[model samples]
Target: MNHKEINSFYTYLQSQQTSQRFLYQCYKKIDGIDAEAKSYENCTVFMYYLDHGIKFYNAGKKLDILMQPILFFYGMVHLLKACLLTKRPNYPESTSVLAHGVSARKRKKKDYTFLEDEVKVQHNGLFPYVSQHLFFIHKMPFEKIMMKNLLGLIPDLSHLFHFNNQESMINVSKIGSHTIDFTSRVLDNYHLTERAFLERIKPYLPPIVEVKSNHTMFQIVLTKPILEPSGPFFVDDNQNIFFPTIRENFLVVSEVMVHYLLLYNLSMLSRYEAEWWGDLLITKPDVDYPFIAEFLRISAKKMPLLIGKELLKMK
Candidate 1:
């Protein structure tokens, strides 16, 4: 298997690398960009990237040309997301102003007791949203780096607790999207028992959650509700995806297993999500998105077992 450079291949790579760095710098330059956008009365940098992304897709049939749309998308979405999560305000304000917005509806002050818990040296991290994605990449053999990069977009687990073999798991984390994507394809294509298959996988699930909220110092816990739902369908409320055609609407079904993976690892994963969203040090005084809190409210019990019912039906 041999391939040639798509002309400005190195240049394109440099652009992507540059995009990665500047996108990260959006936090620093956001106020200036915002001032310009506001003076010109235009959308913010985040929306600008998203709009360009859509335009590139709708332009025409994209030539392989270094996987332009996919790579462009990879860089844009992650960077834009980082900026949006950092939501710089129009005027001056303390950074924590946004932090308080996204925190969950705490039943009591005790709910945040984990904040006072002791810190420990930790290493390994969790690979999330793997179940649905793993199946698509491996079993279905979708060999695009789009899937690989999307899966790697948000790697690692809660800073509160980590595993030991992060060195090896990090490799798996990069390959996780492919692996999880492959797994879903296998489940549907091979007509495996969804219940029995997941049940069999229960024993292999890792335990890494350290709930320091209660009197317990550092007891390990696993967020495992997604593994076993009360009915054939698992209900999720926040999922609002639009695909006009039946053939093009596979994302809804495909993401069902992703929801499962998220549910199973909600504990540590929630913390990770919050920390990233709340990362204000990178930005000068900005508000953070409460992505973790919104994620917590997703009704898994109500979400349809998308892959089990829809994808399996297609098979």
Candidate 2:
């Protein structure tokens, strides 16, 4: 969906009655809570969370690149908090849950590059909370991830990476509503036979109904339509799914979580490492500028659509 459509969709959440009804169902389904009572108390706060998120997103659009990360990161946080409320009901159960839930290196080396920078996942805070509650992902505490890997995970930016002579992903051809196809080269990349490949991916994807293959291509038939991203697979701008070229644990990281990590680090750099951030943008000192700029633009537009899709699934 486009920004206008997503903005209008979120606008519907402004209704207290509607939000209460929605939360009532979510609370009952997700946590078996007293749906009506909890919804009654939380609906207004939920609406405000979403409202604040959209406002930050809208304001970010008018700002310069230097300020966009701060706005977008907090905007993403609010939306994520709203999502958490649907599942957890009593979000911010403790002071720890309110933290950013991830951290960057305390100090950068003299020759540090943005792409080489990393963030370590924390045990408590919004990151892990949202991951487990909303997305059902359980991340290892203090697990470190590099900026290059996170950027490669975004399907929209895959082409940019390719232009820079790095192959990060392989496009999956959606053959039908319930089936997807990819070349045998994928198997070659992993050095796995069709049967072996299926076993490796079965843990990550939805249930498979059947598989069809020839020498050149393999077709995976799913039991149902893929409504959201899973494992190594991610939805592109056209809403089609693609696979990462490299098979790694970070492949399990959802696109939403990836954006959160990158934005958190960027927001921190923008706020605390202002001199470096300014030099990176104004001086164009390295190759990070184009990728970073492209990501900021893409994340500004795509994050809302992903969040909107998540909210729609609740309905």
Candidate 3:
């Protein structure tokens, strides 16, 4: 497609209100064409469609479908954002806060022993109701980067794994907000089933107990279960297997699939709720509220289906 056609396509997508099926058809048609035929100017346009398709699949109500697409979309967005933001400067600044207190000389250091107590009190406060969005956007990236690195180390799969390939598959895992993303590019490039890929690299996977304390906790608590039934399997550089446990590993995989389904349902519900919330917010931005709260709520709701489709291709 030419630049004009690309622009027209984007404009049409932006303007048309339709069911997800219609949008999917459009994506299938565009994706079927050769990228080489498109002009440089149309590249961004094509990317936008790809991005949109991902968003749709991710927000869908089906976890099974949402898994791969979300990963792929995330990878694409990560690559795009990295390209655009890498050289951009970020400024650092701090805010000042007012202090509260009592008199000077009479207030001995012992009197301030309560300061430690007060600090403890503050720490105890607000430990629960943490923001999920912040956790997903900020904390999850580091974990994902690590997972990507682990997948990268999978010997034979390493050649097929391109961390920087924008179009690569083996997109995100949907086990949880923190699950590893896989993209279709990985599957397509490797030409292997997920099970086959895992089995091939089983010999190289690090021992479960060998991982560091901090990393081990998260992996054990959050990630290991999902990958269970597959193995307590560990790989040496020489491709030797350590743990031969089988039944437990399979159970873990089953649990992982359940978690993925939960996340998928949550994403769908959140998106549906966000649409109504967005309408309400649009009519009243006068209220003192964070736009990001609304933005994330809406975005989360809409992403599952789009991301799901991209992931389904991996299978």
Can you give the TM-score per candidate against the true fold? 0.20, 0.91, 0.17
Model 2, 20-112: lDDT tens digits are 988987888865578889999999999998989988988999999999999999999999888888878877799988888898998888998
Worst 10 residues of 2 by lDDT: 170-179
Instruction: For model 2, state the Cα shift of residue 169 in Å.
Output: 0.9
Better of 2 and 3 by TM-score: 2
lDDT of 2: 0.84
Of the candidates shown, which would achieve the greatest lDDT relative to the real structure? Answer: 2
**Per-residue C-alpha lDDT of model 1 across residues 1-315, encoded as one tens digit per residue:** 001222122123234343343334333445455443342222344334443533443331243322232333233232223223233323213333222111122232322322222221111111111221223322322211221111111222111112321110111111111121122333343355544544543353343233222232122234542232211111222221111111111222233333322332333323344543234223323211222222222312222122213212221
Worst 10 residues of 1 by lDDT: 167-176
- Candidate 2 residue 194 Cα shift, in angstroms, is 3.1
| Candidate number of the best TM-score | 2
Q: Please give, for residues 19-75, the per-residue lDDT of candidate 3 as tens digits.
A: 132333333344443323322223344345445644543543244322332443343
Q: Model 3 compared with the native: what TM-score?
A: 0.17
